[model samples]
Target: METITKIVTRFGGVSLLPVAVALLAFVLIGAPSSWVTLTIAGLAMGMMIFLMASGLSLVFGLMDVMNFGHSAFISFGAFIAASVLAGLSGWLGSDLIILNIAALFLAFAAAILFGMAAGWFFEAVIIKPVYKDHLRQILITMGALIVAEQMILALWGGAPMTVHRPQFLEGSFLIGDITIEVYRAFAFMLGLAVYVALYLTLNRTRIGLLIRAGVENREMVEALGFRIDRLFVGVFMLGSALAAMGGAIWAGYETLITPALGGEMMIVVFIVVIIGGLGSIEGTLLGAIMVGLMANYVGYLAPKLALTSNMILMMVILLWRPNGLKPAVK
Candidate 1:
């Protein structure tokens, strides 16, 4: 047990597993251009997943809340953002880059605001009552999810809605023999920016210190004159906002929106959270990238196994590191 603990500890110090996997895949594929394309696509997908999963990870890790209905926020965000974008179609279609950016920004902002409001209600009404009760949390959150989906159906109808990207974000640029979509590049950059901002906020700020301290020992933090509950509430709202932002971005990525969007994405989000280790942002990012790469690579190499690739990856990783690549609590 001591030896095993030491090994896990050693591995936890550095995040090299994902890099090793990428290198192995590159060698196995034996096609530089194809590998490069897959890698870029994988990275973009990973970033989107990271945006969605990061919030859940933080909430679960810090607040110990099992929010099964997180996808509801994602769906809501998508719909809200889509609506905003649709209303601003003129700006989005304009030839000016500034107008295009403004339209996209407005859509994202609306989605985030709505998500924050919904999160507040969710925490206040549904989640707060079931604190520390995993079974109840699951049941209640799942029930909320079903209701949320029904609400979406009523609002947006059962049909999938098409999402249109701004003119500037529509096409792809080629690098040698490789084609990279503009939106995907934008998504990757946006995700990276968010990750960097979050890392800084959590590691280099006082609020972050309080959040971590509160998570480790709420009583101690409370005694220090901070309102731990309020802090947690803020965290929940932030998580929901992030999920909504992800949903909006993903809606544009898919160029279609559906009520089932959130539910469909929940699987990937949970996989990322679990594999990355609950509450560990760095772990989540790495896990998301690995999953993204595996999906793209496997889809191209063996289409039949694409759906199960993430599962297989999860199983293998769990077998290797039961607590995940990096467990915040541990």
Candidate 2:
């Protein structure tokens, strides 16, 4: 085990996991074009999931909060973005690209803003009292989730709402034997961009330094006149906003959403968090990408095992490294 860890570390550690998985899949599939298509789709799926899971990773990993209601932000974001796009159908279908872009921006912005506000409220009202109590945190968050679902049903109703794509985002880019959807490409780029931004913010910025410090020694940071509580609130809000953005993107990817979207996604989101390890952005990204690639490859090669592939992957990874591929240092 020690020798294998050293070998993996020498070869860029777990960052090479996605590439390794791809290589193995390529050999098994034996078709370059199909392989390429599936690979792109998998990456896109992974990115979207990363967006949803990243925040929860921080909330659970760093803040030590078990927020089962985190999915509420996802559900609200999807519904809100869908509603905005629905209201801006004319702009979405317009011949003008600027209008389409504006509409798209507005939809995502609304989702993010709502997520931030709702997160603040949730943290202040429900989560604040439950700190350091995992059992109550779970019970309260679950209750909050139930209420959120009810609220969503009351507002969006029981119908499945169709999400609209912008004019510029519609269609596919054909390259010889392979056809790649423009939306998928956009999603990949957006997710990659978000990951880079988050990496820089958490690893490079002053605010990130404080957050990490607080996690390590809250008493010292507090004694230094830093408001640890406010910092945590900000962290919670940021996490919620990220989830909302992810949900908004996912809504476009699915093109149709129902009130039960959050409930359905909760399991997958939790899986990604657990797979990535707590409090590590890099780990979360790695875990999400692995799940994405595994799901797509398995679905294509063995349809019957598609649903269980992630669970299997999680088990294997845990058995190999119980703390996950790259857990953040405490």
Candidate 3:
């Protein structure tokens, strides 16, 4: 580890080795037969990862709490949207615009409230005492995840709820020889906007500046005028809200919400946070792209590889740069 760090420090991260290796990947295996489709799918997958990781990264950044329940929020969002659509479909003629608009707004409101509650409880109880202890946080959060999962099962009945694609987003568009789903395009656009908004919030606002400061030196900020404690709560709320938003968007894409999704998806999110570095937004983006692309591209070659690609990526990145893509700034 010391030797690798020394090498990176001396040679710098922009060395030719990475570029050469990247070129080699494309050379060894040229673009797939359906290169365009594959590329589009890969991009879409990566963007989804970015959305999920954004929330995870922010939570870890401020609270230092790895809320595995982030996935639960996603499940909740999907379920909420699915349920609303289901209700509307039964009475109304299943209009796409109305269903989508209704689902989106309901999901958004539900998610915000749910997320805020989660954040408040976490800070008021589990996290405040163990703020500085990694092991304790891990155990407590794991327990919380299990509890949340059970609650989901009890509430949603563990059924696989499917989301009906509205008429407007149900089909695809033909472009020359290829076709593209309208929903996928919408998802991409939404993800990009979320990313941009997060970046601006982190880099362009006073609250954001305080967040950066708090992350760097929580005690120091407390020593000053600001209420570092409330800041923690605010950060927690923000993170949870982001996760919930991702969940809601995911509901539209998958059209099915399952209780197990929280546990299942949380693992990937954990990897994203670790591989991308604890709190660096840039690292999270790059890491998500890497993980997302790996999953999509490898799935094309082998289903098994697709399932495990991100884990492998994590191992490789940790081996090469154990601190992750971008280590947290002090």
Candidate 4:
């Protein structure tokens, strides 16, 4: 097993799978315009998925917590962001770009703050007692997810809510025969920014070093006088915040959200996290891009295969590399 693991890890060291798949897709699709459009759309979609999945990966990889209720935060973020955007319709509706940007920022802020608070509360009230026990963590978190869905229904009712994008973000621009939506571009940039920020924080900062060390050996880190518990709590809060931010961005992309939004997206998020490697942000990005591209390409080429594409992808990848494309060393 160890030998196979080493070989797989070595083989997966360089991240070119997504690029390889994209090239193959371009050839198979055979339409430059259509391929370009689909590829951009896929990248945008994958970035959003990465945003949502990154948090879960971190928590799972670092804290070893099975948080089935993570989706609740996503739903909450979408609803809250939607409400904020609705209330700020005047600003969002304004033709002024600055106002539109402000409104969007405010909405995202509200969602992230709410997510942080909820995450802290969840960690303290529900997760603290179940440390190191996967079964209890799963059971309790799943129950939490159920209750959260109910709460969402109670608060927002059982109907789909529509979200309107800012005036500047509602349309598309054409580059030759290809069209790119403004909102999608924004999502891609945002996701990329988050990824860069996270990468730097994890790889270049002292806090990130502590977090990594803790992940590898919690006892060793704590023995060095750093309170690993507080660090972990902070991680949970950050993870929840990221999930909410992703939800907010995604809500704008979809233009419609329901109480079960998070529940529905959970599958994709988990798949991305799993395929990307449990705790690897880079892997998550690659996995997300691959899934996104696969979905768009398959959906365009064969609609029937779209729904099952991710599942098939996961199965194939797992068969090739059991620990995922880039599993955390710890």
Give the residue spans of candidate 3 off by over 4 A. Answer: 1-33, 90-99
The sequence of per-residue lDDT tens digits that candidate 3 reaches over residues 92-171 is 24554676566556655776677668767866787788777888888887777788778878877867877765566667
Off by over 4 Å in 2: none
Q: lDDT per residue, candidate 2, 233-276, as tens digits?
A: 99999999999999999999999999889888888888888888
TM-score of 4: 0.96
Total backbone collisions for each predicted model: 0, 0, 2, 0
Ranked by lDDT, top first: 2, 4, 1, 3
lDDT of 4 by residue, 34-78 (tens): 999999999999999999999999899889999999999999999
Better of 1 and 4 by TM-score: 4
- The alpha-carbon lDDT assigned to residue 253 of candidate 4 equals 97
Question: For residues 1-330, could you state the per-residue lDDT of candidate 1 as single tens digits?
Answer: 456557646866437666666788889889988988888999999999999999999889878889999999999999989988899999999999999999999999999999899999999999899988999999999999999999999998999998878999999999999889999999999999999999998899999888767656778888999988899899999999999999999999999889999999999999999999988889899899988889998998889999999999999778777878877766
- What TM-score would you give candidate 1 relative to the actual structure? 0.95
- Give the distance in Å from residue 81's predicted Cα in candidate 1 to where it truly belongs: 1.1
Worst 10 residues of 1 by lDDT: 5-14
Off by over 4 Å in 1: 1-14
Reference-based lDDT, each prediction: 0.90, 0.92, 0.70, 0.92
In model 4, where do residues sit more than 4 Å from their true spots? 1-14
